[model samples]
Target: MTAYEAPALVISECQQGLLDPPPGAFSGLAAQAAGRGLIERTAELARAFRSRSLPVVHCTIVHRADQKGMLPNSYLGKMAIEERMMVEGTRDVQIPAELGPEPTDLVSSRATGLTAFYGTDLDAMLRLQRVRTLVVAGISTNVALPGLALEAVNRGYDVVLAEDCTAGTTAEDHRYMVDNLLAMLTRITPAADVIGRLPG
Candidate 1:
C-alpha cells in the first residue's frame, strides 16, 4: 500500500471562536493563526484532499445553550462556559468560510471534551469511509491537534500532521508542542508535502 493509503483530512477546532476569536477571547490564538496563515494552508490542503475524493472530516467542539453535558474540568473548559463560546447555534461554532465542508465532506461535532473522538462518531465516520491514515490540521497545536493525534493513533489510525496548517496560543508554544509533543505522536509534515503525496 502507498504511504497515504485511504488517507482522510481531519481538521479539528477550526471554528470561528477558537481560530478567529473575538477581542479579549483567545486573541492570542487568533493572532497566532493569522500570523501562520493557518486557515489558508488548511484550505489548500482541503482542496487537494477534495480533488482526490478523500474524506474530509471536520471535528468541531460545541455546547448546548444550557451547557448541559458540558464539564468545566479544565481552565479552557471553564473559560468556554463562562465566556459563552461555541454554543451550538452560534457563529462561533461554525467553521470559517475559508475552508468549505463542501457537499462531500463530513462534519463531526461533539458537545464536550478536547479531543474529537471522545464523545463523537469521528472514528466511526472515518471507518465507514475505510480511512486508514489521518492527515490532521487546525487550531491550537498546544491542545486539540496533539490530542487528536494521540486519539487517532490509539484508535488504530496513522496520523500525519500538517504543521503549517495549525497554530497555538503563541509562536513559541506552537513550535515547542510540534517539536516535543506532536512530533512524538505523528509524522509532522508541511501542507505542501502532504498535498504532493496525495494519490491521484
Candidate 2:
C-alpha cells in the first residue's frame, strides 16, 4: 500500500480509571493496559506500524476543559472534578514504560472524551499526515472506543477497532460499543487479523 493507503494505528487510553483503576486479568490500577493484555497486543501493532514506517498515534484523556464540555450532566461529570488527570506533564498519568517508541510516542489531550480530536490537535495531526484510516486498540471501549469511532465516522475516515487488542470497563459496554459501531460507525477486526498483516 502507498503511504496514502497505509493504515495508521491509534492506541487510546488504557490507563487506570479514576475509580476502578486498571486490573490484572491479574489486579490493580497500576497496569490497566498490562493487566488486560492490550499492553502486549498494542506493542505488537505498534511494532508493525513502526517497521512499515506508518504513522502511529497515542491518545489519553485528562479533561482540561470544563465538566460540561467533557461529560454529560450526570454524576460522572460531578465525579470528575479535576482536570488533567492524564495531562502531558503529570506524574500520575504517564504511559506504561513497558510500551515503547520512546517519550516521542505520546499525544496529549486537553479534554475528556473518546475522540482525542474533540478538543485537541489529533485530527489536525492525522490530517497533516493525510491519514484517512485508523486502527484503534485500547482499554475502556465503552468510553474511548465509541468516542473515537463516532468521531472518526463524523470526520469521514475508515476506522477499525482491533478486537482483543482492547477491552472495556465491562463486558456489556464493550460488546455494546463494538456492536453499535459495527451497526453504524465502523468495523471490528480481530487483533490476529491485524497482526497477520504486519510486514513480518
Which candidate ranks first by lDDT, i.e. highest? Answer: 1
TM-score of each: 0.97, 0.76
Give the per-residue lDDT of model 2 (tens digit) for 69-155: 655454444445543234435443455655544544547465555456777888888888788778887755656677777888889
Q: Point out the worst 10-residue segment of candidate 1 by lDDT.
A: 1-10
Query: How many residue pairs clash (N, CA or C atoms closer than 3 angstroms) in each of the candidate models, in the order given?
Result: 0, 3
Number of residue pairs clashing in candidate 2, backbone atoms closer than 3 angstroms, sequence gap of 3 or more or interchain: 3
